[model samples]
Target: MRTSAREVAVTAELNLSQVRALEVLLEEGHFGRAAQRLHVTPSAMTQSINRLERDLGVRLVNRTRHPVVATPAGQRFMHQAVRALEASRAAVEAARGVGAGLLTIGFIDGYSQAESRLLDRFHSENPDVRAEYRQLHWEDQVAALVDGAVDVSFARPPHSGVDTRLLDTRVVTVEPRVAVLAQHSALAQRESLTLDEIDELEVVTSATAPAEWTRWWVIDPRPSGQAVRYGPAVSTIHEAVASVRTAADSGSGHVLITGESVGQRASNAGVVFVPLVDAEPCRIELCTRRSDHRPAVQMLRALADAACSARAKTGRSVQRGAEPGVGVK
Candidate 1:
């Protein structure tokens, strides 16, 4: 059997023709189309694949029917081969152009759902672009952008040094992230609950104190001394919500905190929201990368702006509906 080094040498010796043939075979799933893509006859494509299999001593293609399939091992190897080839091509393009490398984007966790949808729309418009997203803590999100670990980020302001543009900014009401407790909880029936009512109940926050405080104070103003006491701190919104629900269902807890948007998200979850009369601030803005100007980044920024405008128009429509003299026929 060949040693790993020998196998590496053999793979290295496999020509671009063989790689292209395999790539097209994997993509088109038919030998005829693979041959057409490579501008070679079907027999030539077959010879190339046969040569590759002979060199690797592995069956790369399952030649069963009109359409072809790769064995499990073949699929794994083909995936790596395609990625390597794409990276190699990108390297060549980067050498020719000043700004053509992959754009690594970072975002705060809770904000990803909205930003990700925008990114999807952007990708559909610009199919040739390559990008990545990492969910990062708010503080670390900005630092990642600064350190060049990430090319772009969706963040809230106080971000400096890089060129900055506003992405999607939303006005959110801060209320007691009230726990929808068991029917037996003493505070459950209060028509309007104040922060003081649940002061003794266990609470939860999506992130650390500093991050949560930044968002709460900047986005939703609350009295400095009126912050809720957390019981078990969690790193994600889902985790926090789940913790609250579990605690409530088990009759072990009576309090939690979340954003105003939770109503739309948790309609069937049996949770009730109580606005904290003391909760003050009501809006937050998301900012995008400022410094590195890549085409994909610009596309993302534009998508964000569009999403923000759409959200604003939606808010206006709702407000108009609520106005006394305005009615939709």
Candidate 2:
């Protein structure tokens, strides 16, 4: 008797990683590339495919080709794998009650002060609700929120070239942008500089970041319409700083643009921050998916708004020499 595709039983239990590997391999069409995407070695990717094929008792990939091709059975299995992964993610969200029990928050590196304050307020109001933080890279900020990897994120704005119709944002703080350069660099001696002065210097950027996002961060086109020079493309904040330091050490000028808070927190020995007198201020916002209307998210958003308002009021009060309020309302 012939068994249907759904009726076929596997000899071994397949894990989510294996399913994800198969999906990525098919999408990338190359073992090495797939391995890189999944942060695994090429040999590990090969072994995973071998195990998957062994368990399923069918050849899933045609390995003879330069760019791999999925076999007939593999193509059919791929469809199911996609659905299976989706179901698995849904099950996890369901188990967590989608922010009812746990609220996973994502934040970019060097921008944790505001997140910590917000979490403090959230915890005070929500004693029983569990919350955790995840550090996100510049390129993955918006994607993390959209993919449900985090319930919410504290990140910079202009998610450029990304579809954010399903996302919502609230401006938490608008801080000035600063230029980061090597401590030994000539520019570090200057107290402040304008964008035009740094326009000629190469700017460190992310390799995988959206073009518009990178442009905004680097302020690509100046008021004079000259294009900003691009330097080494880095994947992380540390790499960017290292590139700048290396260039500085070699007597070559390189710069990185980041928020004032991040610049002030630079603990790296060779890095120094200088205020950008003419640059646009960085807008740090609380980003959340529009589809997620859970109470936990709403509470966090309200607290963010209240905190921002209180800070603004306090700043004005201090400027006017008046006493500020005691706690967040």
Cα-based RMSD of the predictions, in order?
A: 17.7, 9.4
Candidate 1 has an lDDT of 0.53
- lDDT values of the candidates? 0.53, 0.74
**Residue 256 in model 1: lDDT:** 54
Lowest summed lDDT across 10 adjacent residues in model 1 is found at: 320-329
Please, what is the TM-score per model?
0.47, 0.67
lDDT of 2 by residue, 265-321 (tens): 654889888998988776677888765666878888888777677767777211211
Best by TM-score: 2
Worst 10 residues of 2 by lDDT: 320-329
- Model 2 lDDT at residue 232: 87
